[model samples]
Target: MPTQLLSAEQSTALGTKPHYAILDGLRGVAALMVVVFHLCETHATSHLDQVINHGYLAVDFFFLLSGFVIGYAYDDRWNGMTLKEFFRIRLIRLQPLVVLGMLIGAALFYFQASPAFPAIGQVPVWKLLLVLAIGCTLLPVPLSMDIRGWHEMHPLDGPGWSLFYEYIANLLYALGVRKFSKTALAALVVLAGAALIHFAVTSKGGDVVGGWSLEPTQLRVGFSRMMYPFFAGLLLSRVATLSRVKNAFLWCSLLLVLVLAFPRVGGAEHLWLNGLYDSLSIVVLFPLVVWLGASGHIARPGTARLCKFFGDISYPIYITHYPLIYTYTAWVSATRPTWQQALPVALLTFVTAVALAYACLKLYDEPVRKWLRRKLPVMQ
Candidate 1:
């Protein structure tokens, strides 16, 4: 809760800023895995499909990583900085590219031969602008523009739903809930209630593996499902501050727990079961990630570069992938006899997503972030 210790740690590290490369590499792995999972939705085998569905668990990883990274980066700032400053820093870091992606996406929808958008004469200009405006801001405008469920993109950006949660989570953290015991307790209670709700909902539908029946609405509810993982990370941040393991066996045991809990490549029968698996996965992964970070593994030259690069472009890839995937799939479907008939389309879509992510990172994300940083200074 005090600022002095954190400030000292930061100053000492700044001569060479603490590099969390392993975490970055982990991020790259997570993002790419999600892409593969989504791509394989149509053809993957039972075991593989089970594991692939678990790919959605990557969102948990992101939330955990966010908690750890924010704690690592701004713990010092937290002690001294006002809530406004904290919020401003997050905006500067996260908002610009989001806006750019939405604008570009909107344009693509406007001109493309897709049925997703209204024709020029019939365009609801004010409604469209309103969607963009609210979307570009921190507010979650799901029902405002008749956007009812998850995956409803205003023409272009599909990953917008996750961003909504990310923003909300960040706001709660910045507001100093992370420092409050009551906040943490409340989070746990909410998570328990959510787990119960998921169990009830999933059980009534009957337990069948193959024909997945969770609605888009059910999946949307899963977003609230993330608070558990986030708090778990917070709890681990505190746990990590304790005495180190006395033996290699202890660390090994922790590692084993993590792996065992990971939703075994595709085994969960329902969202509730999935939630249990995910919670275990985070608990296991969080400590390992922290230990790796603290031990200087992330600072290894090659590993550091890989992590930093992925972490930088990770958001763009997440936000832009659906459109890129859809567009690529559509083109392949039109040109070829059967889109899924060719393996090349999947590979091509992946390559294109990575390329566009890199471009967005370089052309829009970094520059706008820097400009915003200059425009609204973050307290040191």
Candidate 2:
């Protein structure tokens, strides 16, 4: 996820810019859905029957938001900023939590040794630390280095795969894509959208879900998943005219939840049906939601505070929640508990994830980013 909208303090410290408060709130909404999606995933026998089926699309939505935010925040500033400076600013915004997420994963690594993650118990300390070190850098490990048996690029934190792609998108933007003419960028988006549809509809599973691995097929899924939404958002930012919409945040958030929580479109016999749904949602619905969100303004103090809280915790929760999920998944797999049995713990996990994320944000993320900006005067 790109650090799309900055907090009031951050914007003031850097240079004041108008806030997309509703977009920030929508991001927080998506991030929470991702947690719920993963929690519900532990109970799913397969993706076909998974609860919050399209929650994976939140990552795609994030890419879209990232593109819009990057374009809005930095597209014009390149005249004054070097590529290295841009990368450094991004790293300062993103890398601190990435390191903390990996650290949390490593701290809880041994606790999650149930049947669900059979390999965790057997991983040597040296090897585990090695992965931890690499994961802290947000670099993808090879499949041979898969210590969790899930074959995730970063076994310590599976979601790091998306962040890896986030970095790639940032790199591409800095290197050349940022310089593309509007027409050129739109053409690239069309091609990328075509690729996304092809992968989603034609896949054996009929979903664009296998991007965490390093294999060729997975790599295609990864790139296809990233390209269209990011560029589309970028394009939208450059071209779309904003009109103030009343209750836009509520309407957009509800739209996001409806699309994301909508049930599987076609069941076992018609896999491509869900793929088509996936493509449509990403290609059409997400951008609409983003446009509406961008058009919104916070009209009340209570609503404004809610949006700010959600925006502040959004990234931290997304990056750090999965480690808790690893433990919860292990418990579910090993125990096979009924919903009644698991409800309390599930609620606890949700609450704890939110609490921990907020704690990390206030205690670590804010302070570290502040220190970095101070040390690197160029960021200021």
Candidate 3:
């Protein structure tokens, strides 16, 4: 799979780069599934019963995918770049949405007054602001100051925790991991993958779904989840042999949806079996999905356009949509609405999230990054 070339006008309009377009489409596909998963969570009494049972694995997919992209994009360019410059580019690309997510979460905090969070109504404005301030820095809030009753690092924006780990990944790449020899990186990935497997199998819930808290066990889950896939992705980029695959995007996407949308592999009686499923999917299945996506070229005009649309919206939709999920979660928690009763409202939440993400991408994220690129001039 040779790099796709763009004409001058197309390059100008879409920005310059040789991207794995199918990979972009896959990412967008995963992001959309995440929203559906969160919506289904509203109806679930617990993780065991949740629909879209394995959607949390999308974050691991994202981590692996991120590492691969970063390696492919940046690994050879460090000679011409500084650590400060690298951090600046990542921040410009990612931080605007972080700020927007926190703000949206804060705005909707009170409106989400429901029985699940009985103390929600009594939470102080200043405390909310304090949490917002911390969240803006992408730092975890302590249990003492838990504002949303979920004890999430970012109570206002639950998904901010992933971004926090993402930042850590970037920092490691910039400071140290990028310097490792392939053999060293492989060792790291192997160790991390083992730890991830152990954590998944032994986890109380028998899944690696615990990345939002600041507590010790959850912190282990977060880092365990983060390490293997991110580094494996990096390794994949270094070693990938890009062979042409027919209808690769369609096939890869179907696999992704099936994995994420599949029912829990094992019920409560055999939790460890499900853990094995989760670990294997992250360590094995996800990399295959990414490889298939990367090895193909988009041949059809319609498919190319579709991948472009999804690729563009993927990050914006991901970072911005969780705040809306918070509101939906509140609603469902309060009303205990059946799927039939909640169908219309759930559909509305999905549309609103997609619409909001698109609007923010166009009006806020893109414009901000453009300006940052102009002013900073070192975004690579």
TM-score of each: 0.72, 0.97, 0.96
- Which model scores highest in TM-score? 2
Model 3 per-residue lDDT tens digits across residues 1-380: 44342211123323456767788888889999999999998889888899999999999999999998888878887888788878887887789889998999999999988887777899999999999998888988999989778879998888899999999998988899999999999999999999999988888897989889999988888899899999999999998888889899899999999999989878988889899999889999999999988888888888887887787888889988988888888888888888999999999999999999999988988888788778877733
Candidate 1's residue-wise lDDT over 1-380, tens digit each?
A: 10011112233233344444445555566677667666654344443334345566566667666666666666555557677877776777667767776775555543433332223335466766776786576344543344322225333465565666677777777775567674564567367446634543464322112111133544445444456556555555555653333332224333433443344432445544554554455556545654544443322345445556666667778776766654543444345434346567788878887888889888877777667767776655
Collision pairs in model 2: none
How many pairs of residues collide in model 1?
Answer: 4
Predicted candidate 2 versus true structure: per-residue lDDT over 1-380, tens digit per residue: 11234553336434856668888889899999999999999999999889999899999999999898888878878778888888878888889999999999999999999999999878999999999999999889999899999989999999999999999999999999999999999999999999999989989988888789898989999999999999999999999898878888899999999998999989989999999999999999999998988887777777777888899999999999999999999999899999789989999999999999999999999999889878875544
* Regions of candidate 1 where Cα sits further than 4 Å from its true position: 1-17, 42-51, 110-129, 143-155, 181-223, 241-276, 283-300, 329-340
Ranking by lDDT: 2, 3, 1
- Which regions of candidate 3 fall more than 4 Å away from where they truly are? 1-17
Q: How do these models rank on TM-score, best leading?
A: 2, 3, 1
Off by over 4 Å in 2: 1-14
